[model samples]
Target: MVSKHTLLSNDLFGDLNPKDWPISLADLPPGSALVGGSVRDGLLNKLSQKPDLDFVIPIEAIKFSKNLSKRINATFIKLDKKRDIARLVINGWTLDFARQVGKNLEDDLLRRDFRINAIALKLSKKPEIFDPIGGMDDLKNKKIVAISEKNLIDDPLRILRGFRLMCELDFELEKKTQIFLKNNVDKLSNVAPERIKMEILKIAHSNWNSSVWPTYLELQLLKKWNEDKLPNLELKRKDIFSTKPIAGVFLAKLICLLSDEGLSSLKFSKNEIKRCKNLRFWVRKINNLGLDNFSEDERFQLHVDLEEDLPSLILFLNDKYANVWLKRWEDPSDPLFHPSSPLSGHSLQKALEIRSGPFLGELMRHLSKEKAYRRFFTNHEALEVARKWTLENSPFL
Candidate 1:
């Protein structure tokens, strides 16, 4: 179509060239079409680090994917047999093959969630685009529009996915699409928790000058599966703008949105659950430790206590507190101790002449606190404090 060719030369094609399409597209089976996200990304410069190429093969997908994998030396994976979908992974490049939806390609494209993700490129020596749903216009405008009103009804996951794309591609949801999402927000309960968690992570990890997450919450998308609601925004909402180093910072905001019951209900993995719990606990702990400023060493030790969760801890802090804590950690002039201790646990054990036990952990905690708050500048001074602690605190020992 003339309109399709016109879109090919637009700013969306800045990053990639259609001529640079993968070798797999060079050959094709009958009724095969290079459609959906891969086609959109090719035109729109939205290709991720590893390009994911999606294809529609109305024929036997498993047999074709396996053959294609062998031909290209890629890994063959069957995603959904009933749906007739398979995948070929080669050197970080994922080519997903799915059986055509409905009776034909036009029907398939129309059934997709968003028009922007519904375009296709015919498989031939000279591949021309097939834009049945006006996806090109949507891309040029940087707007996400559902191909049809039944988009959310067909797949509830798109509610979260729409917001994810908004964050990922720096696009806005079209008014009617937003309305559709709001009306069907509760439909997300039908989607899997694992799928929901991944979408949540994508939103949390999105690096954007302005955020759509608050809007996502406003639409009640989170409560579809999660009965618990994000806390009222009436409380001092942290300013997202003017904030730096905000990667995964949304998890801290996420903590504010959840209670213990709400968190437990999402069915996060054991480790993920622990990390989130640690985030919640430390936020409260630091808040309670307010006004009485921790000494440089004390702050460093507090950061050390938080261990792997230091980023989220920094996120929990107010701007002033974050700046102070970051300065203590980063500024060379600041006197915060090295995170890697000069004295090992073995050295501490030797100084205290203690064997392995629960008390060793307690002793380490006390020594770390003393070395921090008590202004012990050397390991020897720390040992002296340890001796005094043993005499006074370990009376039962």
Candidate 2:
């Protein structure tokens, strides 16, 4: 009987020479079989451990498979005593193979989604690029084309994934694919909202935000999804790449645009809607401040008021004013941009000897605003004011 260690070592060193070992085999888990045999001998044994195993390659070893172990930092070990079976971990995913039907790497590339992602760079002897589906040509053309028409139908989420690819790679959707997308926009509703939100956020953060909306409009996806809810969201060509085109604003404008179409549909959660609403309110506030006459205190207050919304606010303000406002805020002499607040609820409680309750919380909030505005300098002053307000309003005090 062949020992498990001998079988594993032979498979591990089978295709790969000792000189080309990318990772030390000693790092692998002890007592673990690198590759296992197929069902004919004992398929149930393999299936029982399927959860721990990664991928299984058939008999035809594709070109991409040659260096798969090196690329993924896996140890290629064989399991079947009767055949040349092997298994390896690639990028933490277990890749296995039965000595039955292994095709070359070109076959694997052909099975992927877009042509752009199908191109793989080899790392072994006579290293050459392998593009099975004109992926390099598509990349050169700056186009996003699917590997096959059936790929999209098999997974409708690919429609949104295509949109995300446009944002990430700054590529254009092929006209035929665009048409198909428009025709099948309703299929997106079948996908989960969380997934849709993820893709939309990716687009909103991309440099192609402005271009993305028009595509959304042209494809009638906005209408189908009932995204028109915000007001006066005119998507000019310039807005696509604007720095202020964040996810919140994009969603707000899309909702507003959809609302205008008499649809009033929203794809975000309640918290997300609230965040967008807050962003819109603050963006308007910052915009109306008019950078020319913006005071240091006002800018500082704006920063404090916006808090987490500051970056997006600045982006929005900059987009509207064309860096005029951002430049103004960047000036060292600008007073509106203040330092961080020195007060906190805990500090207030300790300083005032107050218990954990709404009274102290309210007092702290009032003091924070006063401190932010530079109305009070010392804790004593803040406490005095809080005492006066508490005494005037409450008999308990």
Candidate 3:
């Protein structure tokens, strides 16, 4: 077994063996070196199953990547023409190639977001790890330390990315780095919405999000996207940890924190924004009018509206209510939680001689509520209720 000291001293990270690479690195330019997240994760011994490999080449990144793609049968995409950044995708691995940023490797590494991501490993038969910024020590200490505040300011999206790394690695931001991020948090307003949204989603989906999310809110990193200064949200770990971690619940909590305007400005999809609105509306209603005080219609509507996103609301409920709601929701047959009508619109229209219109739509909703509350059991009973409703509402007919 190789010791940690040996792994570092020999510059041979086990998880990054060339044999495991999706395609050969042999054809890369002579000065090509693997850099960024893959190197950092490799040293931490936490490389993901499908690691993203980034390479810095001394020259002709786009041309080299296009040629490499044809040779290896990988899909090549030119990311930036002027900067000569390109990507080659093969199997599940994504390999990014970029023209080295400055005159040499150390200069290129220095411009990266954080020390941990600044380290590079030469793509040679005998790989050499370069740690010009003391990134190895930062990794050993499990800290996210920015190489320089100026580097983060150049690309302000990296400010949020630091917290994302914290969520992914369960690492602490060094005190000075936290201050640096806080000072430059407002600069995120200058970042492209797509980039900001991408980093936010990554932070939300991390397994350790519950650990770092509170800190993220406290720092108000995305305040410009909010309607006002973001509140210091209380994210109780128990609220999330009580049940199995769910990506939907995490995303829901994150988006719901944003204003409708904020969500739109950040380019959240229409469906995503709609869901956030629904969640926000219900969360306010439930908070103002206690759940126990909900009319049967309101309660049924809540389940109907949130059938797909019930777990998102769990973050706001106390333990007992969360568990009770979750238990019922877990059962697919729970009519009150899942809320389906015993009879279809077609079946009702056929049985009741009701035309397809606004009236029919309302009747279907009424029947669904009755079914959800167990007021009617069978299709025949549902039909009977529908007939009574039509007679009472449209006696002339």
Q: Which sequence of candidate numbers ranks them by TM-score, best first?
A: 3, 1, 2
- Candidate 1, 1-397: lDDT as tens digits: 5575745644333344444544444555866777777677777765665567788877878888888777778888999888889988776677788888888889888888998888887665445577887988998999999876687688888887898888778898898898888988878778877787778777666654344656666686776344543333222333432365534455665665455555566666667667767667666666677726656555655656555555556755567666566555544333333244335678878777777677777777666555545468877877777778777877476
Specify the highest-TM-score model's number.
3
Cα error of candidate 2 at position 258, Å: 11
* Candidate 3 segments whose C-alpha is farther than 4 A from its true place: 1-13, 208-211, 228-234, 237-243
Is 2 or 3 the stronger prediction by TM-score? 3
383 Cα displacement, candidate 2 (Å): 3.9
Stretches of model 1 off by over 4 angstroms after superposition: 1-23, 208-211, 224-250, 256-265, 285-305, 331-342, 395-397
What lDDT tens digits, residue by residue, belong to model 2 across residues 210-249?
A: 5666776687654555542333344453443365443333
Q: What are the lDDT scores of the predictions, listed in order?
A: 0.68, 0.52, 0.81
Q: Which candidate would rank higher by TM-score, 1 or 3?
A: 3
What TM-score does candidate 1 reach? 0.82
| Error at 262, model 2, angstroms | 17
Displacement of residue 371 (Cα, Å) in model 1 is 2.9
TM-score of each: 0.82, 0.57, 0.91
